[model samples]
Target: MNVTLFSKPDCKQCDFTKRGFDKHGIDYVTVDVTADDSGRQKCIDLGYSSMPVVLVESGQEIVHWSGFRMDEIKALAYLEGAPQ
Candidate 1:
């Protein structure tokens, strides 16, 4: 599984998301939306008006969401059939 976190500076939700991932030991790539126009465009394209967006890619499946979703994070941390 590949995880990408799209975030901006000084975003509390982004900080929470990063801390959650860190606490769960989930390695993810960070994309700074403020630093890159393309990254910011991605958030807009995804129809998100939030600070932090999480994109997850597992094989042929791709999932994405915005905000600090601990439920989703927990599910990702303990996904069935995923390599442990």
Candidate 2:
């Protein structure tokens, strides 16, 4: 499983979300919208017009959402065998 966080530097929710992942020891790659044009377009293409977008991939399935979804992250961390 792979988790990617799409965020800009000024987004507090994005920082909070990343902190949550760190707290649970969940590994993820962050894509900065203000810098990465292609990555930013992808985030926009995923039906998210906001920062703090998260894309989750498990096997051939990919899912995405925006905001600080703690409950969802917890489940994803477990699915990825992250230390709880």
Candidate 3:
């Protein structure tokens, strides 16, 4: 499974998302939308119009969402074989 977090600077929701992932021991890659135009465009292309966008890929399944979602983060922990 692979996780990608698209976020911008000075975003509280993004910070909360990251903290949630950290607390759950979930490893992920971060795409800075503010610093990376292509990343931002990718988020827009994915139909996300928000600051923090999370993309999760596992085998043939792909999941994505926007905003600070601790529930999603916890779900990821379970999916990734981490303690909830």
Candidate 4:
């Protein structure tokens, strides 16, 4: 399953989310909304004004947390059939 993470720089939650993904050995593509206008527009299109929006492979939103929630993410990953 593919994971798409929409994040912004200097976001502590974003960093923590990355750590969680690393711990799970999950491969994901991160799009920095602050650095890229297109990425920012994507976030807007998704109706998210905050950073660290996580998109799962099934077109479901696993997380839209302003802060990192490792356990929640882990559960969502498992439900999505992603590797732990």
Query: How accurate locally, in lDDT, is each candidate?
Result: 0.89, 0.90, 0.93, 0.77
Q: Which structure is stronger by TM-score: 1 or 3? A: 3
Alpha-carbon deviation at 24 in model 3, angstroms: 0.2
Residues 2-83 of candidate 1: C-alpha lDDT, one tens digit per residue:
9999999999999999988887778899999989899889889989978899999999999999999998888888873332
Most TM-score-accurate candidate: 3
* lDDT ranking from best candidate downward: 3, 2, 1, 4
* Candidate with better TM-score, 1 vs 2: 2
lDDT of 2 by residue, 1-84 (tens): 788999999899999999999988888999999999998999879888888999988789998889999988888878877877
lDDT of candidate 3 over 1-84, digit per residue (tens): 989999988999999999999989999999999899999998999999997999999999999999999889988899888977
Candidate 3 segments exceeding 4 Å error: none
Better of 3 and 4 by TM-score: 3
TM-score of each: 0.90, 0.92, 0.95, 0.76
**In order, what is each prediction's RMSD in angstroms?**
2.5, 1.0, 0.7, 2.8
Model 2: worst 10 consecutive residues (lDDT sum):
75-84
- Score residue 34 of candidate 2 by CA lDDT: 95
